[model samples]
Target: MTKGLPMRRNTILLAIGVCAVFGAIGLFALHMSSTSVRASGLMPYQDARAIELGKTLYEEYCASCHSTNLEGEPNWRDRDDDGYLPAPPHDPSGHTWHHPDQQLFMITKYGTEKMVGDGYKSRMIGFKDSLSDTEILSALAYIKSTWPPGIIARHNKINGN
Candidate 1:
């Protein structure tokens, strides 16, 4: 009976290993399908030169509070006893990547107030009164270009085109 115990234990281990492998394979398959299609709908100025122009615009118009590298401010995730984040990072570590392009564009154009309802307020100034639509789109293009391939792929999937 003791000898048979060893065989039973081996069988249990094998089952667990097979389950783990199948779970891993399923996850990978989902990820692959999610990124299969790239976004086709895009801003007009999406070329390399536009991305460069966007970088300059970001530095000039967005750098003060958002930071030069879009890193935002110190303690960006922490509230100043007022329940507001200092300024979130534009990098992948922050929520910037999670938003779809249209939402980001709207936020830039109309400020957070238009999107988040009347009561909400943010330091972000609306570019609608100052920047043209083309310029705004270019700025977004530049930011997207900075993201890693995987992040971009995921964003494309989220856009569903």
Candidate 2:
């Protein structure tokens, strides 16, 4: 009975280890499977049709978080002590216009994960899984369409175009 008892304990330990290893592997796989788009060469959309599609996508996905008029949440610049803003306006009033198109694309596709890094979680969800590259471009076009001509020119300059 004593010998059998040792064998049973060893078996249980092995089973636990196996389970732990599998659990870790599963977590790694899950992380890898996440659909986060990496930055790619810009796709030019110098047409009205592309702009319209982009507008539609923005209305469907971004309008809720960014607000209908692109006015983000109120008092967005004033971050609390914990460093979370109340979702600032995406309009010219906010700093969204300040960022280049590539940065904006990354933020939208990879979300705050790429923007903040580490465990700096944000409510921003990556659109990589939901939106294709073309759709993302369209959405971006839509956002850019919202900006004034001056803001758009500034952004183009920042992008080195």
Candidate 3:
């Protein structure tokens, strides 16, 4: 009877361990699927309509600082007398293409300060209150569409494409 009791306890523990392993595998699979879907859906830089809409939105909200041609502000790298860095260009001449798509979206929606944290001062303000996620993505797509093929490919690789 004592032997049987120990055997039964061991079997129960083994069963629990199997269940836990399977549960973890299932959760991991679910997470991976959702992540893939989210990543794929976030950027549609190839869609002409999205690019056009993005261009319009950029002109309306961003052109003042970023420039109509996406050339960004003059002396964009230099800090002003107030210690504020000017808006950087979105063109290939600037660093915009260096960032991943998701990061660019976040920076646009939340602004540079929020992403950098730690009392970082940026003249760029969050557009979350004014622009929808789609609009923000569109604007980013428009910026990306202007990049050369090699640059676009590099940016895509950066995003794990």
Task: Give the winner by TM-score.
Answer: 3
Which of the two candidates, 2 or 3, achieves a greater TM-score against the reference?
3
Against the true structure, candidate 2 reaches a TM-score of: 0.67
After TM-score superposition, the amount by which residue 61's alpha carbon in candidate 1 deviates from its true location, in angstroms, is 0.9
* Residues 14-127, model 1: lDDT tens digits: 567435533443343344343322234444334888899898998888887888888888977444676454776787876676665665666677676444543554566679
Top model by lDDT, which number? Answer: 3
lDDT, candidate 3, at 50: 99
- TM-scores, in order shown? 0.69, 0.67, 0.75
Model 2 lDDT on a 0 to 1 scale: 0.65
RMSD of 1: 13.8
Please state the error at residue 142 of candidate 1 in Å: 0.6
lDDT of 2 at 83: 54
lDDT of 2 by residue, 1-161 (tens): 77799878867875674355334433433454444533333424455787798878878998887877878777564445675645656666776666655666666776764455545535677898999877887877766777787887777776667
lDDT of 3 by residue, 17-75 (tens): 43553344334433444332254436788999999999999999999999999999998
Clashes of each: 1, 3, 0
Give me the displacement of residue 131 in model 2, in angstroms: 0.3
